[model samples]
Target: MLISRNIKMADVIHMNYFTLSVLNRFGIELGFGDKPVEEVCKKHNVDIDFFLEILNTFVDKDYFPKKHLQSFSVKLITDYLQTTHDYYHKVKVPEVESLIENMVDSCYTQKENIILLKKFFDEYKQELLNHTHREEEVVFPYSLAIEEAYQSETPDKSVIELMNNYSIDIFQNEHDDIEEKLFDLKNIIIKYLPQPKDTGLCNRLLFVLFNLEQDIIDHSRIEEKVLVPKIREMEEILVKNFAKK
Candidate 1:
């Protein structure tokens, strides 16, 4: 999509491919009514500034702040991340799996291909859930503890010890690999999936895969852009101000 200064908040998806995904990621459902972005956001009860910030970040990667995660609590972002995990596990993954099942039964000639797709999806789902589990069980607790104590000006000894043993750097290094398989899943669907006897089923599968890919990308941005950077800054502060004390 060619971006231009003329692309106002009122522009519709017809005008900007990226805006539609931005709205969708924020759970906004809109038609191409060409409504101003602020009005659309107001109708959906979304904070206009936050929505715009997200959209701008999506449009321009450099727009996201590099130095600090402010204007919201780390707890708020972490809790939202947890909700994303729940949605992925209980809703998103299951919905896509069900779509595959229906396609398998309906696309008799493509059943084998559908089966392969399902197996790949199941593997991806489990891997994602496992990743979420590690963040929830180990990283989040420690991150929040550090945040909680940092806010109180009392960095706990245990959190410091825990940080020494576990690092977000490890997670950071592994994240790209985890996302790599999903990219392969998408390309296989887009390029190599045998034509389902039912075109509708094929389209549905593609829609779900495309949406899931975009959603996962947004989720990763929240983690890498917001959570990791905030934690890194917090750790730096803790070491300098509290470590020797």
Candidate 2:
């Protein structure tokens, strides 16, 4: 992973190329976060437990902020609790609540709110959920697997090289796509919440969307700069071991 403060929020995997096939297969409008785990699992053909374990890992790492119960809304927290089976209950619920409140007050109150408010919320939820699932299930596991393969006594150099090269090429390509889509979505939202619209609801919706966008960008950076490189290094180690054999 190439660590730098340079990458902005829009340059993540959705903007990249390799994951584009998966993203297109998965579709971008509805996003992966809003759908049920079972549904996302079925759609992506990922394992549920495996997915849960990965989410739990990230949550534990505080890669995600713990949902602040005192400051956040109850309903949002409750929804997350139900969805994640309390795995993120203590950490994510509060933030989820705050997001819900902001979205309801800001985005849902606009004149155009009725047209796509529900859709927006649904997509928002699905996008976050799906993002987490992808990292935990597909991306992380493959990464860890590559790392382990590189560390084994009799490392499989061919497999290590293939996985490393493919992951880097594919994941980076998808990051570009994610960025473009997010930029388009942001533009659409901004149009809907044009300036001088001082409604309390409009303010909240725009704020929430802006914050969510920031989170997505930051998360993508971590994966690209941190996770991707880490996995590649591990693959390199495996190759070195193979040479010794």
Candidate 3:
């Protein structure tokens, strides 16, 4: 079911606990009582439409409101994306790393295999860091700049030069499949890695890895499906307008 403003905040959590992370990204905490989603969003000063869209998209895999998401300002989208990056960096990555560390420490047999697993994850994490760093430092700013230029009555000539040098198509082409490695990591644990002494620890590590993988998939969907196309459209408009000058 699609989430509505009238739905109770607590009920939303009951519907999809995964949304707790989504709520956290919006700075919405757990003590919302029985307040409706709209009321809670207003209290938190979040854009209600954007919040609902994000929640629905996460809740139902088939429910991507691409046009609706594209209607939001680039800044809003980028800000949310940045918050997601922060969550991955500060919380998810560390939680996964810690679990893997615990698993490695607790397991006695096949220690070398576990160590190699850790090495693989470390490489994946570094690649993820590089991807996000480039998005934050280069892609997002360029997207925002396109929006600014598109909105400007008299866009600076520099924007044309910027677009000429770097376009959204370039970003889409260079977008890496970082989550693919997570799939391999999961397969390694599930298929190849011998059962750890602490089955619980291994299970926890797999669970965390799965969650991170899904989260990254959703994150990439928003970027590639929504943000990239929106910026591309804006870039096209800006180019045409500049050409008329």
Candidate 4:
């Protein structure tokens, strides 16, 4: 169901608990006292429409509103994406790492395999960090520049030059399949790794891994589906105008 302003904030959480993380990225906390979505968003100074769109897209996998999401400013979208990166780095990554450490500790017979599992996850984590770092340092700034130049009546020649040097198409083409390694990690745990003595630890680790995988998938979808295409459209317009000049 598409989230709306009139929907209760707490009810939204009930609808999909994953939204709690989404709310956190928005800097929203959970003490709204039965207020509606609009009220809570307003209190938190969030863009109600954007929040609703993001929530609806997250909750209902089939409900991506590409055009609507694209209509929002690039800064708004990128800001949210950056916060998500922060969450992954500061919270999710550490949490997963700790879980893996505990899982390895709980294992007795498959010490080598568990050590290998840690090695695999460590590699994946480094790759993920590198991926997000590139976006934060390069792609996101380029995208923001494109938006700024596109909005300007007199687009800057420098930004146009930057566009000429790098295009969203190039980034899209070079986009690493980070999730592939994650899927492999999951398979290794499920199919190959001997059952850890603490079954609960094993289960918890798998659960967190699955959640992280899905979250990353959703995050990438926004970049690939919305951010890239929107920037590409602006790049075309800016280039055409620059050529005319």
lDDT of 2 by residue, 79-122 (tens): 33233322332334345456445554554345355345446555
Q: How far is candidate 1 from the true structure (C-alpha RMSD, Å)?
A: 4.1
The lDDT for every candidate, in the order shown, is: 0.71, 0.45, 0.89, 0.86
Between which residue pairs do clashes occur in model 4? Answer: none
Residue-pair clashes per candidate, as listed?
Answer: 0, 39, 0, 0
Q: Report the poorest 10 consecutive residues by lDDT, candidate 2.
A: 1-10
By TM-score, who's the top model here?
Answer: 3
**Residue pairs in collision within model 1:** none
- Candidate 4 C-alpha error for residue 95, in Å: 1.4
Clashes of 3: 0
- Residue pairs with colliding backbones in model 3 are none
Estimate TM-scores for all models: 0.77, 0.47, 0.94, 0.92
| C-alpha root-mean-square deviation, candidate 3 | 1.6
Q: What would the per-residue lDDT of candidate 3 be over residues 11-108, giving only the tens digit for each residue? A: 99998788899999999989988999999999999999888877887777787675755567889889999999999999999998898888778778
Better of 1 and 3 by TM-score: 3
The TM-score of candidate 1 is 0.77
Per-prediction RMSD in angstroms?
4.1, 15.8, 1.6, 1.8
| Better-scoring candidate (lDDT), 1 or 3 | 3
Task: Write down the RMSD of candidate 2 (Cα, Å).
Answer: 15.8
